[model samples]
Target: MNALFLTFLFPLIGFLLLSFSRGRLGENLSALIGVGSVGLSAATSAWIIYQFNVAPPEAGVFTQQLWVWMSVEGFAPSFTLHLDGLSLTMLGVVTGVGFLIHLFASWYMRGEEGYSRFFAYTNLFIFSMLLLVLGDNLLLLYFGWEGVGLCSYLLIGFYYSNPNNGNAALKAFIVTRVGDVFMAFGLFILYMQLGTLNIQELLTLAPQKFAAGDPWLTLATLALLGGAVGKSAQLPLQTWLADAMAGPTPVSALIHAATMVTAGVYLIARTNGLFLLTPDVLELVGIVGGVTLVLAGFAALVQTDIKRILAYSTMSQIGYMFLALGVGAWEAAIFHLMTHAFFKALLFLASGAVINACHHEQNIFKMGGLWKKLPLAYASFIVGGAALAALPLITAGFYSKDEILWEAFASGNSELLYAGLAGAFLTSIYTFRLIFIAFHGEQKTEAHGGHGVAYWLPLSTLIVLSTFVGALISPPLAGVLPQSVGHAGGEAQHSLEIASGAIAIAGILLAAMLFLGKRRLVTAIAASAPGRFLGAWWYAAWGFDWLYALLFVKPYLLICRLLGRDPLDHAIGLIPATVRSSHEAMTSTETGYLRWYAASLALGAVVVLGIIVLA
Candidate 1:
C-alpha cells in the first residue's frame, strides 16, 4: 500500500522539480525526469499489483488511511486510497498506458519550445489521474477530478501564444465545468440523502437505505451521469475534445487514450451498485452512449485533420463503453476501456510520427502513400485502424467491442443494439476511410524518413497490444471483477458476435470502395446537395455545438457584454453617492455647538412625534 501511494508521489515530485526549475534543467534533463518518473510509477504499480495478487486483501480490497480529512458530529471522511479490482484495473491503465505515452512524448516533444513546461504538465496530469482513480471517497475523487480538468486546460493551451489554443483551453475548461456543477450537486444530494461520501460505504448503504426507483437516488445518479457525460465526451458536452487537438499530439494521446476522457467510465463503473438501483438512469447511460457514438462516428467520417478524426473516434468508442455500462456489462466496458487505450494511443503516437515526417501536416487529405517512406508508422496506423474497426477476432478491439455489441443485444434492447451496430459500422468506415485515403493514395508530399528507437518502440508495443491484448487480458479481468458484472460468454450469444464482425467487415469494404482504389460513388455523393448537407451536419457533430451555442454560449457572451455597465453597478452607484451625501449631512449635525445640537434634537423629536401620532 505504501508503494501504491508512492506511485502518485513520483509524478507529483517530477512535476514540482521540473516546474520550479524554470528551464534551468534544459530539454534533455526535463524529458528524462518526466519520462523517468512515470516509468518508475508504472514499475511501482506493477509491484503493488504483484503483492496484491499474492496476499490478496480482505474481501479483495485494500484501503490505505493516510489521515483523518474531516469530521463533524457523526460524519467523517478520511484521506484514503481504496484498492480493489476496479481501482487496480484503472490504475493499470493510467500508469501503464501513461508511461508509454510519456516515453512517446519524450521523443514527440523532443525540442519543442515549452519542453520543460510540457513535461511538467504531463507529469502533473498522471498524478491527478492517479488520485482520481485511487481515491476512496467522492470528495477526494472530486479533488483529483478538478485537478485533471485544470491540468488539461494547461496542457491543451500549451501553445498559448496562439489565441485559438487559449480559446480551446477555455472551451474545455468551461464545458467540463458544466458537468462538474452537476456532479457537485449530485454529491451534495447524495450526502444529504445518504450521509456518506466514502464510496464503499455509499455502495453498501445506498441500496439498503433506499429502494429501487427512489426519486432522490435517481436524481443523484442522473447528476453524476452529467459529470460522466462531460468528462467522457458523451453527448452535449463532447464539443470540446475536437478542439482539444490544439495541444501537442502526445497530449492528445494522453487525454483521449488514458486520462480525462476515461474518468467518466471509471466513475460509473466504480459506483455500479448505486446505478443498478436506478434502472432508468442505467437506461439513460445507454441512450447517451448510443447516440453519442453514432453522432461522433459521423463526425469522425468527415473530419480532415488527423488528430480531430481520432478525437471524434475517441468520443464514439467511449460511447461503446457507456453502452456497456448501461447494459450492466461492466467487465466488457472496462475491457474495451483498456483495449481502446492501447489502440487509440498507438493511433495517436503513430499519427504524430506521420505528422512529423510530413512537416506537421495534419490534414489526412494532404498525406498520401507513406507506406515506404515511414513504413513503421504506416503499419502501426493500419493496426490501430484495424483494431479500431474491430477487424474480426484477430485485433484486440474485436474481442472487446464485439462483447459490448453482444451485451447490448443480450439486454434485449433492440434500439441500443442497433445503435451500437450503427456506431460500429461508422467506426469501421471512418477508421479505414482515413487509412485508405492516407495510405493507399499517390504520394502527395515527400516525407522525411527515419525515426529513432524512441519513436518505434512505443508504437511496436501498442501495435501488439492493439492486436492481441484484449484476448490476453479480458478473461483475467473477468476473474478480477465481481461475478455479477456479467461476462463475455454465457448469454452473450455467438450469433451476435458473428453479426458484429460481419458489420465491421461491411464497413471496411464500404470505406475501401469509396476511398481506396476507385472513389466513384463517394465522388457522386459529394456532388449532391443532400450529401453535402449531411456531410456538413456530421462535420458539425450533428449541430449539437450550434444548439449549445444558441442555448448557452450566446446567452453567456451576451450577459458578459451587458455586464460592462452591469445593473448591479448602477444600483451600487446609487447607494454609495447617497450614503456619502447623507454622511456629510450627518457630519454637519455633529458640530460642537449648543444651537446645532438643540436644532438636531428638536428635528429628531419632531419627526419621531409625527410618526408616533400617525401610528
Candidate 2:
C-alpha cells in the first residue's frame, strides 16, 4: 500500500479493534491499541514527510486515485488522496500532535468507566481528520467533514449520564449544522459552475475560468466562510465551545485545543486559490477574524473556570490564524496553527493534571499556590502561558504570532493590525491571570498531589516540542510549496518585527501590572462596574442557556401548540364524529340483515336496468 493509505488505515484499525472488542478486551490492552494505532499513523506520516522532502512531488501537488466511488449522469467522485504543501503541513499537525494527545488521554482517562469507548472515539476522530486533510476532491473532503462532526458529537456526549453534557453536544452539532447547510450550498454552486468537485481541477481553472469578483464566487466563498465560522466557533457561534467544557478534560484537550477546531483554518488555507480570485471576500476574512480575536480575548479575561478561560483563548488564537489566512499569509497562518496546537494542548493537559490534583475543582478562584505541589504541571503551564502571551525571543508563539502581525501591518490593513494588537494585550492579561490566580497565590485548597508518570511524561514532551517547533517550520515546511506560494519577501520587514515585539512586550507588562501587582485591588475592582463587565465577558456570554430557550424552545413550543388547535384539525375531527353518528343511525335500517341486503341489491339492479333501457 502507498504511504497515504497506511497513514489513514492505521487509525481505522484502532477504531475497529476497540469497537469490535467492545466488552472483550481488557481496559489497559484496549488503551494500548488506541494509542498504538495513532502512534503507528504518526510514524507513517513521518515517513511520508521524509519521502516528500527527498523526492518532492512534481507539479507541486500529488494525487492518487483509488477508484471511482460514484458516477451519475454528469458527476463523478473518486476515492482519492492528495498531497500538497498545505495537506502535508496539516497532516503533520493532526497526526503528530494528535498522537501526543492520545498518549496524554491514555493517562488522563485511566480507570474511568468508559476508557475503551474514549479511545475508540479518539481514534475515529483522528481517522476522520486525516481523511479531511488528505482528500483530493471536495466531495471527499465533505465526507471527512461530516465524519469529524459525527465523532465530535459522540465524544462530546460521551458522558451521557449528564443531561447538560447531552445538551452541550446537541448545541454544538445543531449550531454547526447551520453553517454546514451553507457549505453544502456552496459546494453545489461550485459543481454547477465548474462541473467537477476535484480540488486540483478547481484551483487550476479558478484564475482564468472564474471572473474576478464574480457574484457567484463571492456567494460561494461567503457560504464556505459561514461553515468555517461555525466550526471554528467564531463570533455569535462561539458560545457552545465554552459550554463544551462539560466533557472530560482530555476530550477538551484533544477536540477543543489540538485538532478539531483547526479545521476552519485548514479549510481556508486549502482553498486559498479560490479565495485569491476574490480579494473582497479575503478582506472580509480579515475583518471577521480580527473582531473574533478581540472579542474572545475579552471573554477569556473574565472567565473563572479554568477550562472556560482556555476555551475563549482557543477562539482568540484561531482568530489570529484566520487573520493570517485572510491577508494572504497562508504560510504564517499555518505556522501559527502548528505552534498553537502544541502550546494549547500542553496548557489543557497540564490544567487537567491540576484539576485532578485539586479533587476536580475547576474554579480558578478556588485554586492557589499549586506550583509547589505539582511542579511539572506548573512548569508546563508557565511555558504554555509564555507561548500564549507570545513573549519576545523565547517562546514559539512569539515567532508565529509576530510573523502574522508583521504581515498584517505590511499588507496595510491597519484596522486588522490594531485589532489584532489589542487582542494580543488582552490575551496576555487573561493567560497570566489564570496562571497567577491558580499557581501564584497562597494555598487556598487542599492539594492531594501524587501525579504519576502518566501525567508528567506527556506534559514534559509537549513542553519540549512547544519550545522548539516554531523554528523548524521555516525550513522543513518551506520547500513543500511552490516558490511562488512560499513566503514572499516584502511581507516580513525588520521594522515591522521590532514594532510587533514592542507592542507584545507592552501588553505583557500591562498584564503583570493589573493581575500580579496589587492583586487585592484588582479583585475589588472586579466587584465594581467596569471590571464586572469585563469579567462577565461583556455580557456576550450571559444567559446562553436562557437565550436558546427563548429563541428555540419557546418558539417551537408555541408553534406546536398552535398547530395542535388548527382549523383543519377541528374540521376533520367534527366530520369523523358525525360519520360515526350516521353509521349508528344507518344500523337500524339493517335490523333484518339478510332481507334488507337483498332488497337494496334488487333496487340497485332495477335502477341499472332502467338506465340501460333509456340508453
Candidate 3:
C-alpha cells in the first residue's frame, strides 16, 4: 500500500480495535495501540516530506487513487488521497501533535470507567482529520468534515451523565450545522458548473471558467466562507467553544489545538485560487477575522475559569490566522497555524495538570503559588504564555504573527494592521494575567495528584517545540508553498515587526500591574459600574447566546408547541366523540318496550314497501 493510505489506516485500525475492546484491553495495551498508531503516521509524514524534497515532482503534487467511491453520468468521486506541500504541512501537525495528546489522555484518563472508549474516540478523531487534510475531492472532504463533527459531539460530551455536557455537545453540533448548509450549497454550485468534484480539477478550471468579479464565483466563495466561519468559530458562530470546556482536557487539546479548529484555515488556504478570483469575498474574510480577534480578546480578559480562558484564547489566535489569509498571506497563515498548534496544545496540557493538581478546581483565583508544587507545569506555562502573547524576537508566535502584520501593512490595509496590533496587546494582557495570578500568590487551595510521566512528558516536548521549531521549519515551508507567498515589500515591514513586539511588551507590563500589582486594578475595575457592566457583557460573550435565543430559539420553541397542540388535532379528535354521541342517540331507539317494538316493526315494513315501490 502507498504511504498516504497507510497514514490514515493506522489510526482507523486503532479506533476500531479499541472501540470494540469491551473492557478486555489493559490500560498499557490501549495506550500502546493508540499512541503507536499516530506516532507511525507522523513518521510516515516525515518520510514523505523527505522524499518530496530529495526528488521533487511536478507541481509538488502526489496523487494516490485507491478506488471509485461513486459514479454518475460524466461525474465520479474517488477514494483518493492527494499529498502536496500544503497537506504535508498539515499532516505533520495533525499526526505529531495528535500523538502527544493521545499519550496524555491515556495516563490522564487511567482508572476512569471508559478508558478504552476515550482512546477510541481520540484515534477516530485523528483518522477523520487526516482524511480531511488528505482528501482528493470535495465529497471526501465533506465526509471527513461531518465525521469529525460527529466525533467531536461524542468526545465533547464524553462525560455523558452530565446534562450540561450533553447540552454543550448539542449546541456545538446545531450551530455548526447551520454553516454546513451553506457549504453543501456551495458544493452543488461548483459541481453544477464545473462537473467535477476533484480538487485539482476545480483549481485548474476556476480561473479559466470565471472572471475576477463574477457573481457566481463570489456567491460560491461566500458560501464556502460560511462553513469556514462556523468551523473556525469566527464571530457569530463562536459561543459554543467556551462551553466546550465541559469535556476532558485532552479532548480540548486535540480539538482546539491541532485538529478540528484548524480545518477552516486549511480550507481557505487550500482553495486560495477560488478565493483569489473573488477579491470582494477575500476582503470580507479579513474583516471577519480582524473583528473576531479583538472581540474574543475582551472576553478572554475577564474570564476567570482557566479552561474558558484558553477557549477564548483559541478564538483570538484563529482570528490571527484568518487575518493573515485575508491579507493574501497564505504562507504566514500556515506558519501561524503550525506554531499555534504546538504552543496551544502545550498550554492546555499544562493547564490540565494544574486543574488536576487543585483537585479539579478550575477557578484561577482559587489556585496560587503552584510554581514550587508543580515546577514542570510552571515552566511549560511560562513558555506557552510567552509564545501566546507573541513575545518579541525569541518566541514562535512573534515570527508568524509579525509576518502577518507586515503583510497587512504592505497591502496598505492600515485598518487591518491596527486591528491585528490591538489583538496582540490584548493577547499579552490576558495571557500574563493568568500566569501571574495563578503562579504568584499565596496558596489558597489544597493541591493533590497530577504528577506523572504521561502528563509532564507531553508538556516538556511541546515546550521544546514551541521555543525553537518555528525557525527550523521555515525553509521547508517556504520551499513547499509557491514562490509568490512571502514576496511582500519594503522597510515598513521591519517597522511593523518592532512595533508589534513593543506592543506585546507594553501589554505584559500592564498585566503585571493590573493582576499582580498592589492596587488590584482588576478588582477595582470589577467594583465600578461601567466596569461591572462591561464584565457582564464580555462574560456573556457580548450576549451572542441571548441574541440567538431571542432570534432563533424562542421562535423555534413556539413553532414546536404550535405543531404539538395545533387546532387540527382537536378537530380530528372531535370526530370520534361525535360518532360516539350519534351511536348513543341511535341506541336509544332500541330500548325494550312492547309498544315501541310494535311501532318499529310497522314503520320498518312500511319503509321497506316504499323502497320496493320506488325501485
Candidate 4:
C-alpha cells in the first residue's frame, strides 16, 4: 500500500521522457521506456494487491492523502488516492492489461511514423486513467476523466495527415464533452446539496441528506449517467466509436479494452450509492445498455472493416456492464469489465496483426484463407472470438456474460434479460462472421505471418486469459460494493446460462452457414432490395450519424452560416471602424506633396491662433 504512488510515478516518467525526447530516442529505447514503465506499474500493482489481500484495511478501504489540492472557505479536495476492492480491481486492469497493450503496440507500431509519439500518447493515457480510478474525490476523478479525453483525442488522431482521422478525433472529443458537461453539473449538484466531492464522504452523506427518489438526487444521478453514456459509447453517443477506428489498431485496443470506454461502467459502479437512491436513473442505465447492446450487435454484423467490427463489439460489451450496474449486480459489472479488458484487447491486437499480415488491408472481404499463413492471428481470433461469444464453460466471456444475464433475469427484468440473450446471439454471429470471412474461404490476397517475441507474447498471454483461466481470477469486490440483489438459486441460474450459451452457439452456426462457404446466399440477400436497405442502415450504424447530422449538426452549421459575419464582433468593430475612417479623412489633407503639407500646416496654425484669440 505504501508503494501505491509508484503506479502513477512510472507512467508519468515514461510519458515525460518520451514526450521530451521528441522522437530523438531510438525506437528500441522508446519502446523500452514505454513498455518498461507500464510493466513496472503492473508489478507495483501486483505487490499492492498482495499487501492489500494479506492485510485487508480496516473498513475495507484505504486512503493515502498526499496534500491538500486547494482550500476555499472549507471547500477543499486533496490530492489523494483511494484504495478498495473496486479501485484495486480497476488498478489491476489499467496497469496489467495496459502494460500488455503497450508491449504489443511496440510490435504493431515498430516502423510506423511517429513511433515514439504513439507510445507517448498511450503512456499519458494510462497515467490519466490511473488518476481516474485512484482519485478519492470527484474533482480529482474529473481531472482524470478529462485528461483521458484529451489523450484519446491525441491518440485517435495520431495519423493527423488524414482529414478523416482528424474528424474522427474531433467527433470523439465533442461527443464525450457533452457528457462531461453533464457530469460537471452532477458534481456541482452533489457539492451544493451535500457539500463534499470526496466519493466515500458523498456516498456516506447522500442517503442521510436526501431520501430515495428526491428530485435533486435523481437529476444529479441522471446527469452522471449522461457522462457515463458519452464516455462508455452507449446509444446516441455511440456513433463516434466506429469512426475512431480511423486511428491505428493498438490505439483502438487501448481505448476500447483498457481505458476510455470502461470509465462509464466504473463511474456508475463507484457511485452505486447515489444511483441506488435514484432508481429511475438506474433503470435508465439498464435500458440504455439493453438498447445499445442490441443495436451495436446489429451494426457489427454489417461492418466490413475488421477494426470497426471490434469497435461496435466494445460498445455492446460495455452495454452489458451497464446492464449489470443497472440491475444492482455491482460485482458482476466490475467482473465483466475485467474479463472484457482481456479479450477485447486480444481481439483488437490480433486484428492489428491481421491487418498488417494482409498488407494493411482492413476490409475483411479483401482477404481470406490466411489461417495457415497467419496462424498466430488465426488462433488469436479463435480464442478471443470464443471468449467474446461466451462459448460456455471454457471462455472468460461466458462466466462474465452469463453472470450479467442471470442478474438481469434475477431482477425480473425480462426485457433486459432477453436483450442480453439477443446480444449474445448477435455476438456469436458477428464474431464468427469476421473469423469465417477473414480466416476461411479461398485466399484472396497474399499474406505474411508476424514473427518475434513482442508480437506473439502479448497475443499468447491474452489468449490464455481469454479462456476459462481468466474467469478463475475473481474480482476482489466483496464488501466493497453492496451485495447484488435478488440472487437466483441453482436451477434458475443454470437454466438461463444454458439458454444463453445455446443461443450463442446457434448464432455461430448461423454465421458459418451464411459465410463459411461461397458466401453466395449472403451476397444474394445483401443484393435484395429490403436486405440491401437493412444492410446499409446497419452498416451505417442505424444511421445515427446521419440522424445526428440532420438534427444537431445541420442546424448548428446553418446558424453559423446565418451569423457568418458575427454580429457581436461587428458591433465591437464599430469603434475601430469609425476611428479608422476619421483618421483616413484627416490624413487626406496631408498628402505626400510638399505644397499640400505646407498648406495643411498653415491652416492648422491659423485655426490655433483664432481659437486662442477667441478664448
Kindly give the number of clashing pairs for every candidate: 0, 0, 0, 0
> What is the overall TM-score of model 4 with all chains considered together?
0.95
Q: Give one digit per residue, the lDDT tens place, for model 3 in 74-108.
A: 67799999888788888888988898888788778
How does each model score on TM-score? 0.91, 0.91, 0.95, 0.95
Worst 10 residues of 3 by lDDT: 475-484
Q: Looking at candidate 1, what is the lDDT of residue 182?
A: 99
Model 4 misplacement above 4 A: 566-615
Error of 4 at 548 (Å): 1.4
lDDT of 1 by residue, 1-615 (tens): 667889999999999999899988887899889999999999999898888778887877888988888889977888899898888888888898899899888888876888999999989999999999999999999999999999999999999999999999999999999999999999999999989999988988998999998999999999999999999888879999999999999999998666779999999988888898999999999999999998889889888999999999999999999999998888888989989999999999988989988999998889888888888888898999999999887899999898788777767788988999899999999999988888778889879764677787888999999987555874234443444333446644677778889999999988888998768899899779999998898888788878988998899899889998788899889988999999999887676999988987899999999999999
RMSD (Å) per prediction: 5.0, 4.0, 2.3, 2.9
Put the candidates in lDDT order, highest first. 4, 1, 3, 2
Model-by-model lDDT, in order?
Answer: 0.88, 0.83, 0.87, 0.92
Name the lDDT value of residue 441 in candidate 3: 76
How does model 1 score by TM-score? 0.91
For 1-615, candidate 4 gives per-residue lDDT tens digits of: 988989998999999999999999999999999999999999999999998989998988888989999999999899999999999999999998898899989998988899989989888988999999999999999999999999989988999999999999999999999999999999999999999999999999999999999999999999999999999999778888888888889888988666789999999999999999999889999999999999999999999999999999999999999999888889999989999999999999999999998889999999889898999999999999999999999999999999999988889899999899999999999999999999999999999888889899999999999999999998889888999965646898888888998998999999999999888999999999999999999999998999999999999999999788888989999999999999999878666899888987899999999999999
User: Cα deviation in Å at residue 204, candidate 2?
Assistant: 1.5
